[model samples]
Target: MSQLCNVLIVEADSKNVETTVPLLRKMNSKVSYVKQGLNVVTHLQKKGFDLVLLADKLPDEDGFRVLRRIREKAELKNIPVLMMLSEDESKKAAFESGASDYIVKPYMPYELVARVTPYISLVLDRQKFTDECQRKDKIAKQLDEAFTEMEIMSRLDPLTRVYNRRAFLEKITDEQIRSRRSQKKFTLLLANIIKCRHYNERHGYECGDFIIKKTAELIHGSLRERDLTARWSGDKFMILLPETESDGLEIIQTKINKVFQESSFEFKGMNHRIDLSFSSKVCTGNDDLDLVLKEIE
Candidate 1:
């Protein structure tokens, strides 16, 4: 690796320490030595190391226990552990305890360099890939949320918080197609406000806006959950009642008319009762949406 390698040595033998530190330093590694297996866990926790060169024998405990402890921790688990064995017999035990590799001593300096370099480079590459994947996933989630909000905004009237004219066109077109396929009928009801222009001229545009919002709330409250409501244009609202017959259209119109008559609007210390003129027609599953809207208008 191009970076400086940090190595923790868990050997107390003075001859091993004298021989190993100089060999690793020649390759520009930062080496820390500890004599006991007990100190290994604490040093690993407080510092970041690239690899551990653990002796088969320690002053307090065996190297196998230390290796198991390192593997058990999530943060330290991926770091490569190379056990230093005095005999050829302990190779199997080293591999079983999750040691990445091992060395037989007394060993050559060049062999130590060869064994340790690949593990350090492999770890750095794996970490880079994992970080990149996480970053891309986060950006994907943010983009999905932004698109959802934009879709909702496009369908709604900004002032009244109800479906806009574009939404009405889309809904009517879809309903017309469904009616033709299933031979099911639906009703379209239009509620036109009386004297809206005169009311806006007398009170102010803000009061006119208040009336539109209140009209939407009243219409929404009187309709079934399955029904769709939209603002067709200035001072006009439309409702699409799916699977409803011609006889049911009058029942809906009467209910909305009654509610609008009963409701009152207050502006600048004046109280005013509103009026609505209702018109409704049942689709025969054959009419174009433009022709339907034109006939009602």
Candidate 2:
């Protein structure tokens, strides 16, 4: 009742069909006998068989042609195909036509059963494996996206979408690992607002918040794709630059100071000047992220 052993047999000779039918039935298979290749497709669509057995030579078409048609039909492409080849069959043609398995004529029922059973089981197993693989791939992709989102939420500065303190440390750890293995350069910056606390006390919390967010924006916008910025904490920030040596850190420090110097934010409809005191340490020979961050701090 489960219909698991369902099969469609398409042997052109009535004698071959006669010889094969009882074997298939003995194996608990449902069988259909066809003597012409022309009818295979229609029968294939109607029966929706799990397996197909064919004689290489046919009245209307060859086994290869039927195989081609089977492949062309999207619904039948995955159905397993077995062909009965002659003693001098074309090995190349049979293989190229996508014949799943081949048996020479004058074959024994026990031998036929032996080869065909594994192939059927293989097709079923492959289908099951392929289905499971696709399902897992889809699930893995979804989970990767979700994990990235959660990481962004947890470790990014909200206003500027830069890495925050936790993210900064994680990135630093990654850089340190990379540097230890290779001769690569890494850099870090410890920056603090000169009078950000004063800005809060005198101008109110809202004004202070605007000042912090504005400073964060300038730093975030200045970074290249390879660079990372983080909200180190309130009134503090850290930056990590990969492939930047000691010389590069100097240029980067100058850039940071210049950006802060030229940029001004308004509080209570009045322009408020901001100042940043920042330090940079580049990972060169014998430099560690923790040590470099401490130097900048």
What is the per-residue lDDT of model 1 for residues 88-207, given as tens digits with 9 covering 90 to 100? Answer: 799999999989999998888878888877875665566567777877888898998989988998999987778999988888888888998999999898988788887799988888
lDDT of each: 0.85, 0.79
- In TM-score terms, candidate 2 sits at 0.49
Please identify model 1 stretches exceeding 4 Å from their true place: 1-55, 65-79, 84-98, 101-125, 266-272
Per-model C-alpha RMSD: 6.4, 10.2
| Deviating ranges (above 4 Å) for candidate 2 | 1-148, 285-288
TM-score of every model versus the real structure: 0.68, 0.49
